[model samples]
Target: MTQGAATPLPTPKERRRLRESRSLTQAQVATKVGVTRETVRSWESGRTTPRGRKAEAYARLLSQLAEPAESAEPAEPAELAESTAPVEPSGPAGTTGPTEPAEPELVGAGAPARTPARKNRRAPSPARPARRRTPRREPAPSERPGTPPEAFDALYAHCAPYLVRQTYLLTGRRALARESVERAFQLAWERWPEVAVDPDPAGWVRAAAYEYAMSPWHRLRRAHRVPEAPPADPEDRKLLDALLSLPPAYRRTLLLYDGVGLNLPETAAETEASTPAAANRVLHAREAVAEQLPGLAVPEQLHQRLTELAGSEKLDAPRSTTVRSGGEKRTRFWTRAAIAVTVLIVGATALTVRVAPTKYEPVPAPGAPISGVPPLTGPQHMTEHDRKLRQRLRAELSGGPQRLAPVAE
Candidate 1:
């Protein structure tokens, strides 16, 4: 049958019998119908009833099949009267039943009421008392002032092994374990203001570490690096090695859920995966770890190792190469000064050449007037001999004797 298809409605007698057969009090039916117990009682006694939508909803609930009643006999008149009477009203308005008299059973006492049992099965179960639990006390404000340094320290002290395990799982390199943790802590320090306020600092660190381990920079750094030997403890080392060998996705989810003790939903949230996806990741990671380390115990030795590793070491502060040593600044200052002086000297030499004035000397072609000198007033058409003698006379006047060329052939 298709889901949500409307089913057949129940008769008033069927509804009342269903509720009673299911061991439901009148109030239960009243609550489902949004009426008082008096109303439910009225419906059962055939005096008053729900109609339209309310009636349909009542019928739907009563249509549910329930377990067969223990006794086959019809209820005694007194019991029937008591069952149909209005009980104390509970829940909201429109849920109370109307006052009414009881009706005779539709079937004889010996026949089992299959219809009632079917309807009663659908009746809602009785309300249960809500459990009360003591809330966990939060750490004092003084004890947990949110700061990058505080968070980094806490993660290093309390959550290092899990991180190491995660790093190992991702890269399968023992040496990267410490570096990954350090890098994750460094990033946390850089963004401490935001990270410290997070509800789960360790989770934040783990996620950051996972991201860092997957980054190109981390990959390049680890490529040439050799794996460090596992620790002396066989169990501890074995778990670490196994974790390191897991794929990144599986390793991250597993560490978050198993190593870090987060619930499935919490792990999903931390890992940015759906709950089902996170569950799958965890399942695969567990299987992988189990397969790799058959003799390895995940619960006992791994937890102990993680705890011990967390306490034994501290995260070192990130190093800075930005600080200048003595004489370095002085050397740079002198270099700049020398370049400035050289530029100025070269500029002055170029300017001197560019601005200096050039002296001019005049040259005249044969039979042409000397430029910038006084014009000659001799005849325009003169014999070649006269021209030569005049040129010689002019040359003599200018303090240089001129030689006349012989006539050309």
Candidate 2:
């Protein structure tokens, strides 16, 4: 049959008769047909007609209903299934049904044909009263001020997987998800009094997780990223691929709304955006998501599928193995490293401060030169010109004629 071809649905009376013949309730039949009980009622009352795949599903269920009543065995009732009482075993003993062909009766035999003897059966044990379990006592409020340990545990159980999955989708890295969730939870723990009292504690943690997931700190560890596909079912793999194609901010807005189950205002507050902006982001993201769907799906169909997909896949649990949060550890390591470097610099500078010979030479005494005039530094201490000048100056001072003397000297 063609995929789009609508299967013929049995008429109202026929459908009701088939349902009764099989001893099934409307709810049971609706579950089999993948519709609500009201839908089943509407179908039986000729109020509406099933269409497309839904019609096909109804047709398939009708075929099952056509089978003999003995062919179907509904599961045992909850009480019977969980019953621990010893069975009150009583049935026709030593009496066989005609499951096996009976041997030909002896001609004109007075005694009735004897059936095969039944197997030996054991007797039931006596019933005993169920032991009552003692109720555990709650710890005093003095031990835990506002929110108790149990409350935090309950919070963690609810939000941890949700935050992790959100981070994982955002970063496309499992380790980052764990790290983000861990950091978010740590912050929550530190401010439990406030967070516990807040209207949306999960919102607070989710915002923190989003921040951690998008942190630039992750860039330093990019080299350590091992290229691998996310753990997903086939359909989810396609969805993830589509999601990765979207811009980071848009992708985040989408997940926060659909994946994280936040409203426009909550998502906006977390994203530090206006409500309109968040809505716009969601719309854009849906458009982007729609592109990832196959050719068979129209925009409306794609949207419906996406909504269903989002609902179905909370990804509340991760893979068996995980790379837990190392952000805190890394922070501590970097802090120590910076401190060590600072210490080394300070020590080296201190050791270098000690005086060097050339740097701290003692000042020489400032006094008159040994000679009245500086001694000549050349090979001939005095030049021939100096000799003449000296002779002229002595002649003049001794009252001799100054003519033809070296007056310049």
Candidate 3:
């Protein structure tokens, strides 16, 4: 009977708006409910209504999106009818009742044709407008007043070793690991207000390290230009070195998942990647490193060591210097220049001594030779001789002797 049929549902626009408010795309909702995007689209567009379990699921999803309706409002039959409206196209044309073709008998065959059923099945409820759920707000800046400098120092002390270990895993060099970890903390200190608020401070520091490692200037300063091949232990020093050699994104992905012990979802959140993308990054990073260092296996001991290191308090110490904008380049240039100058000075001094003529005494002034002095047998070793020799030798010698002459009798 007509009374047994399901009621019509809301127009599609309402569903779309509700989903949009929850920050879900049609595809996302469809995926959650085991339906196609087109089906969701159709539902939202009001072209059709969902039925049975599908309709129930849509209602559930909508319920999740909205806060529970206030209990203060008592449920009424008319209100119930409005709330149970068909979410999909299951009802008869323009009719607000159930989809059953024939009117069912209530109170025996003698009862009037329009009589209601046993009331066990409630009337189809209408679609109420979805309510918005307010997101929990973070503490106001005024309330937080920022973390104290002491807190930063404490955090640094706790976090430093972990950071160093992560840096080592990425760079595989102790010096670079120290440098990267130190620099990361320095930067963190400078931006403590923001960094401290991050859900995972270690993760943030690791990300910063990856950025530092990937920089062009950092690469150029590497003592070992080519990445050191991975060691037999994937968590070994060599493995860490190889990882540091990888592209920043890959390194970040791997460290977050494998090194940091973050699950796929957590890794996705930390790296700002989708679940699938994060999974792919982890897989590829592992494969890439493995390819280069085939002998190295993922060592449980190394993982434990890194985890222990990360958990230690001493590892958190903040470094004195922060990474300045364009600072790496400037520092590299000056360092290289200093090394070059030192090398040139050393080279020049060696050449001047090697190529310059040996000084000789002037026959002991033909009379009284200075006490303890051995008489010179050759040309006078006067200042003038030295000057002249230097000038002549300048062009001929090109500074230093390439090969020394043997001692003569």
Candidate 4:
């Protein structure tokens, strides 16, 4: 019915090939997807499928150079649903032929030549039950966001406040928490695909916020004055103090699992630890937090307290923006340059110590007998009187005359 219809949209494989044909790296694709380069690789390799907001982003980028996805049309012979038998196409007289497109003549041709009429066809088999499990997790139909970018925005908004709140409780500083949320959102935007598709997107950002706030890089930044901290609630203050008391690993695990509401496996993946280790960290951290609480704190109560502290604090991610590739590249270049400079400075300091260059004049070799007495360690063989006489005679010869002082008798 249409002559100028657009070509069909490229498949994911075709999309990746087109991207590569343009000499674009996975990083470039990731920037558009708001995810890291690795996620792009995963998509291309079929390790993961895009869904939710990620699917939208991917579709948009691919669409820029692609055609519209195919529209509904007559089913082809090979792919047609098997509810009905197939029609045989006309070729030459008395000659079998393959199926062909429906033509006005073929519509009524040869009484709709049916699929090779089989003699005594067997009874149709019953439909198989749906598989209980699939190799890969399909996006939950109910959980999927109705809109594409809306999902990304909704997640950003939802996680922002909690991230800020959680980070604030962790650091006891509102400004720092804000900074953590800002950084986490920026990361989430850059890695939007990965975060959005994650089973627990909220947990991802929460963990990221805490990690940002607790980074060793912030050790020196802690002394700066924050505009606010947790209110004068004893519970909040006590929990913060107790949390900071545990080792960093333990602290992070506890917050991710209990405070951020992540499952133990999710917590382990986020913290980059083994499940057993994460479990242990949570166990010990809970014990430590329990000891610090005012009353007999059970597991449930501890979680409740932590949640309260995190909830009471709030970090509003005021912006959901993605920095440009140029900016990120520039920043990365400078970072690498700074690291190189630091390495050079350290290496120079260690390898090339400054030592005072000493003046090393060679001692004058003893020449023809110096017309002076060889005294002390030079020659113990000569007597003191002989040495004095020689010294006196030498002085007399060098100088025209010398006043002879009375010698000690």
Candidate 5:
């Protein structure tokens, strides 16, 4: 038997728009489609496409959704047809106009229909060349609508507690986990200019916390050298041990991918690794964990377990105000220290200049001995005069007046 041609799906963006327009949640869609929400998310993200029977079902659902719009307005069918028509090149010979916007997955039975872009545009004249448009620059963090401080506080309040729990899983030490998350936020606050503008601010903080939690330097600390008390439950203890047993990279990759529910590309990006490497790490970590606890062989089970393990512990994050204040204090201390060092260097330089020799000096020539002077000698080398004196002294011992008269003579 011959199979029918496959349905042409809408762009990823259109797929998402259709669902949102219908006021449907990903979970509701997942339940209807007999797939997980993550699968639906991946489909909408354009990371993966639906295949075979699911594709047909999805296409039919989207057709039904578009059908209402078509039935509601007599004039919409033409626009819908134009939306589906293959985009024609309207620019120079080598270039083409922009393609359809990214869309979400389809949900119904018939072939998927193309959805129009957010704004309607007339076909460009074939004679007119398409000009290159410079991309619009995003506003700086400070330039954003609300107060930056408030934005930062909001971000901290939302992410800190979750990060602490995640860090605990990464390090298997509750105190260190809390410390890692707090330190991460402090660093984030310090670099708020950069962190505030990031597409994934929470991820920026998470990466920092993960890096700090897994740092080799932590191993040198006396407290970190000793393991923390295991979870009270044997299952949790076993799972935690298994996670700790994996290499730091693998453990982090697994957590980001499975536990945190990030897609493969997002996980890889956060881990600073290539997608393939992240995949390998996740696979290896999963195998290792499953070997230890056979019941957690599935990714879903592992995710649930990680959540339970992290939630069971009392890993509380410091207040946003505390983190902000601490960061400010650290910044001030470093600034002061830098200034003091600069002053000290200048003082030392001034002192060196004050004591340094101003001009070159030459050594004096040694004195020459007098040509006619007799050579100096010890008592053993005395001349005839010295011997005669010694004899006169010996004879003078007879009388003091005689010796004095003789000496005068």
Candidate 6:
């Protein structure tokens, strides 16, 4: 097929369909195409387009795989095909190598095509299209203009139960998990305008729930202070313990990638981390879990174990109506608190103005001693000169008076 000009590559959806129709896994395709499974995933997701020599090689490989898939009768559902397909051997972490630009993949290059088994199943005809699964329900009506409170309840009811279980894995405390899921829904309700228009509303709520559940502050809460009881089964207990033992980031990455079955890029996007960092976290988390439960060394087993543990717990979400009411109550409480604070500030200012002095009053000056004045003393201590002057005055008066008296006689 590579000898002639390569057939034009199919659309992303077609590429994925062609691969699945051949019962070929992404890892198998990646192995055959000399690229990482993530690169193949990106190609199918239409995030990036392959180019250069790799593109031609990928095209030829897909064309080869397509020949068999196109001619073969529809044997089984895609899920069943995947289930029956042989598992690829796990490789070392470095097997994927450094991340490459996203590219397409070739499926079933060396693998045998699956043959149809059921006699009752009808072969798809050219006139009639093959049966397809029903598309998932959308939240289109939930975001209509002036949507009712029930719209939020619908969104909550759809996401809350599963999210609670997911958060429980993040934080081992059941109470904290329930609270986290409820709080996340409340936030979503508060930000409905934005969340309603979001591409992935469920993801928005999930991220919020994960953040709140993994918060360090939850440790301070009395209810979350003591650890929750471990799962009854030894295997479930070990798995939960292993999950809780991982760093929050690692655990979240592992759950998103393995448990939730999100691709690496999607997991990275949800976790708000780089792809390589997210991959690293998954590796470390898997290693940690494997240490405790060697049976779960394979990712598929880990995913199954996670599902079982979550299902085993009775971590039911609160009613959506109750959550909406709680959110509304919280909003009202804060609003009233803010208004009261503003009124208090304004009233205090007005009272201060009314009681304040109308004019400035100067303070009185302090008294000080007067200088340059004689000191008061007693007259008993007269000077000798003062006595002499008084005696002379008396002598002169006595002599003059005696002469005048004789002349008159």
Off by over 4 Å in 2: 1-151, 191-194, 216-225, 230-232, 294-409
- The root-mean-square deviation over C-alpha atoms between each candidate and the true structure, in angstroms, is 26.2, 27.4, 27.3, 21.4, 19.8, 15.8
Estimated TM-score for each candidate = 0.39, 0.42, 0.38, 0.43, 0.57, 0.57
Residue-level lDDT tens digits of model 3 in 28-62: 99988889999987886567888888887777776
TM-score of 1: 0.39
Ranked by lDDT from best down, the candidates are 5, 6, 2, 4, 3, 1
Give residue 333's error in model 2 in angstroms.
Answer: 7.1
Give the lDDT of residue 4 in candidate 1.
Answer: 26
Between prediction 3 and prediction 4, the one with superior lDDT is 4
Per-residue CA lDDT of model 6 for 212-275, tens digit only, reads: 8877886777876666788899888888888878888898888776666554445665675655
**lDDT score of residue 255 within candidate 3:** 65
Clashing pairs in 4: 34-190, 34-192, 35-191, 164-315, 165-315
Candidate 2 lDDT, tens digit per residue, 220-312? Answer: 785436675554577766776787789888988776654544434445556756555776787677667766665412323333333444334
Candidate 6 regions exceeding 4 Å error are 1-146, 358-409
Give the alpha carbon lDDT tens digit for every residue of 334-359 in model 5: 99999999999999999999999999
Candidate 3 positional error at 90, Å: 49
Off by over 4 Å in 4: 1-149, 193-200, 222-230, 294-296, 321-409
Please provide, for model 4 over 1-409, each residue's C-alpha lDDT reduced to its tens digit, 9 standing for 90 to 100. 2212133233344455445434357799999789988888778656787777777767777765332211211111221112112244555665333333222111111111121111111122354222221134556988777764567666765556556666665667777778777776667666776766654466556657778888877756546533444467886777788877888888777766555444443455567565557767876787787787745244445555655666565444565534224335656888999999999999888766665345677889877856677566754687889999999899879956668788897
Give lDDT tens digits, candidate 1, residues 160-205. 5446654554555555555666666655665666666554556566
The lowest-lDDT stretch of 10 consecutive residues in candidate 5 is 104-113
**CA lDDT of each prediction against the hidden true structure:** 0.53, 0.57, 0.54, 0.57, 0.69, 0.68
